[model samples]
Target chain A: MEIITSNQNSRVKLWTSLQTAKGRQQSGSYLLDGWHLVQEALNQAAPIQAVIATEAQMDEHLADVPQGVPAFQVTDEVARHIAKTNNPQGIFAQTSLPNNSFDSKYVHAGQWLLLDRIQDPGNVGTLVRTADAAGFTGVALSVGSADPFGPKVVRAMQGSQFHLKVIKDVDLATWIDDLEENNYDVYGTTLSDTSVDYKTVVPEKSFALILGNEGQGLDPELLAKTSANLHINFLGKAESLNVAVAGGILMFALN
Target chain B: MEIITSNQNSRVKLWTSLQTAKGRQQSGSYLLDGWHLVQEALNQAAPIQAVIATEAQMDEHLADVPQGVPAFQVTDEVARHIAKTNNPQGIFAQTSLPNNSFDSKYVHAGQWLLLDRIQDPGNVGTLVRTADAAGFTGVALSVGSADPFGPKVVRAMQGSQFHLKVIKDVDLATWIDDLEENNYDVYGTTLSDTSVDYKTVVPEKSFALILGNEGQGLDPELLAKTSANLHINFLGKAESLNVAVAGGILMFALN
Candidate 1:
């Protein structure tokens, strides 16, 4: 195994760069930390370019690393530098970003989750994980949403990215138009008088559910374009539900 | 308004102590930051021990402060010391903890959410917020759950705690037993083969939903004690839904 002791090492610098969206975009790869996520990447046969681990973690988890993958042993200091959390998990993998494009046929045949500029990394990641749990065909992210590959988001997603498609930077207005044109029952979440209670709508086989920003919610114009807007009816004093929780309820109820 | 510039000031020391579970318990009060939560405390007539704000926040949000409430104007540095986040919302309040013991009659009459040792502050807070949104009567936290008033939890709850009864450190097994004794259809979330799909259970007028920890899920012993165990059916590749998302789905579905 190759050993890396210095934080200034070129490959170490590249691994640390995956912490940012710009770096991930520039390199076309992101870092996955912890045994669970790295193991998921290996199991999914994700394009894992390299594996880096502290000696202790490599000793315990080396069996999960694919035999032909380039392995690097790093000191704890180097591991901590690459990890975003205070407690570094020690095992990390560099994997290529998945292709974000979806075939029109596949988009038309299954449920799709459209996120409109949802910003919280944790919320965005939870939404993707929820989409995976609800059996959505894929998640389409409009501009302004949190980067799906960011470190915090990847941690929250817990490897759901490998299980389904997560397309980013799409123009939601045009995408909604196309889904509607293809006879998909597109539903936007809104709380206007015109919006019906979500439970009142029956689950459809193939539909698109659009959730908006955490605070502002879906844009007024975007809400106007969907087949119908639905709201979750509740009795409490809270003004609204967390977007990800709301998304989960809607997806599970309407899928 | 009392001006507090030194972090060592006695009142400032007291406010800082409220940040921890032990301090919150000993003082019978907790600190709330941000205008929204402080306003909720005022609106709900919660026991507002004191209010602390920067001069600017006091100027902008003073109208919401109740008359005769002891208000302190602190410098930005002192405010940051009291506030948990990097960007402190200058307005804050020190409010007494609520009486956590609910009337047995109240518990028997309305929808109740029982959390079983959920440790994530965000998840616990979101579950409470969702319960509020779903019009549940109150939330009962088991012994090991996150403190409902923790900074992270309070932020995620968005002041919903003021709108509903949140009883913490309760014996959930006994509470569930009491709930079932009163003819409440107590439902426990589990993934066992014998569990029925959540959608199949019709919403009852008064029911208790028990959600478990994020990782371990509901204890098998706890699941075996409920009137019935229910699961959300899904076709996704993800192993399980996030506990908060699962709680939201069940709460909204059965409400």
Candidate 2:
């Protein structure tokens, strides 16, 4: 086991840089830390460019490593420095994004969640995890949504990213238009009397449920275009719910 | 504005110590930060002992302060130190636990959420916020649940603590008995086959819903005591939604 003792190591620096959106895009790589997230990437056969771990964290998981994959042993402090959270499970890997695309052709056959400009990474990640659990085929992240590769989002997704298709930087208008043209009903969460109760809206064979930012919901232009604008009726005093939680409830109800 | 410049000031140290649970409990105080939360506390007439702020934050909401309350002015760094999030709005407060006690007297009214060992503060706080929004009358935190006053929970709730009636450290068995005695039906979130769809369960005119931890759904003791066990059918690939989200969905649906 070769130990990389220096914090200035090129690999460590590169791994740290993946934390930022610009770095990830520039290098075409992102960091997957902790044993669980890394394992998820491996299970999906996500391209692994580099692996860094302390000896204590490596053990049995390294058995499946492919030939020529760069692996390094580093001190706990060095691992912590590269981790987004204070508690790193002493593992981190740099992996290329999946070579996947969301096609309008399949949008009419399954459930999908469309996230519009949700700035909170944790909320976005939780929504992705919930969408996966609710049988959504994939999540389409429109412009203004939090970066999927952001550390907070990754942690919230809790390993669901490996199995789910996360398409970012797409135009919501065009995406919804394509889906609607193919007979997909798009439901957006809103708080209006005109909106149908989420529970009453039966699950469709093909639908796109759009969730918006925590502060400002879906834009008026997009809301007007939605096939069905839905709202969860709250009998209580709360004005609304956490967007991720609201999305989860709608997903469960629709499913 | 009399600024407390010394780190050794008894009040300053006490505020700083609230960053951890042990410190919060030892001093019998919890730190509530941000203008909205402080204002919410004021609105509820919560047991706010001391209010601290930086110049900018003070200027914004100082007029809302009631007469005779001790309001302290501290350095920006001091305010930030006591604040739960790294990004503080520059307002911080120390509040004592309310005099309200958890007993049968408070159980006979409207909907209430009973948490059994839900350890994550964020989940608990989010549930509290949702419960408040859903119009629940109060919340009873069973043993093993996370401290509601913890920083993570406070941030997640977004100032809901002020609006909701909260009672912690109660025995679940005794609490259930009292609720039943008071003619309140108990509904618990479970994955059991006998559990009905949450939407189908018409909430009793007066009932208490029990939500458990993210991993552990509910305590077996509570489950056995519940008049009805309910489950949100997860039709998707994911096994479950985050407990906080699930609780929010169920609370709104039941109401």
Best DockQ among the predictions, by candidate number: 1
Model 1 per-residue lDDT tens digits across residues B127-243 = 999999999888999899999998889988999998888999988778877877788988998866578899898965588999998889987788878989999887888888889
Residue B248 error for model 2, in Å? Answer: 1.8
- Local accuracy of candidate 2 as per-residue lDDT tens digits, B84-111: 4467888877888654465765566888
Alpha carbon lDDT at A135, candidate 2 = 74
User: What lDDT tens digits, residue by residue, belong to model 1 across residues A1-255?
Assistant: 889999999999999999988889999999999999999999999999999999999999888776899999999999999895668989999999988665444356788999999999999999999999899888999889999999889989999999889999888888888888788988999866468888789855578999999989999999989988999877788899999999999999888
Deviation from native of the Cα of residue A170 in model 2, angstroms: 1.3
Best by lDDT: 1
- For model 1 chain A, the run of ten residues with the poorest summed lDDT: A100-109
Candidate 2, what DockQ? 0.61
Candidate 2 chain A weakest ten by summed lDDT = A98-107
lDDT of 2 at B181: 85
Checking candidate 2 for backbone clashes, the offending pairs are A117-A144, A133-B238, A135-B236, A236-B134, A236-B135, A238-B133
TM-score of each: 0.95, 0.86
Alpha carbon lDDT at A133, candidate 2: 75
DockQ of 1: 0.85
Q: Show model 2 residue runs off by greater than 4 Å.
A: A1-13, A45-57, A62-87, A91-93, A100-106, A192-194, A203-205, B1-10, B17-29, B68-70, B73-78, B81-87, B191-200
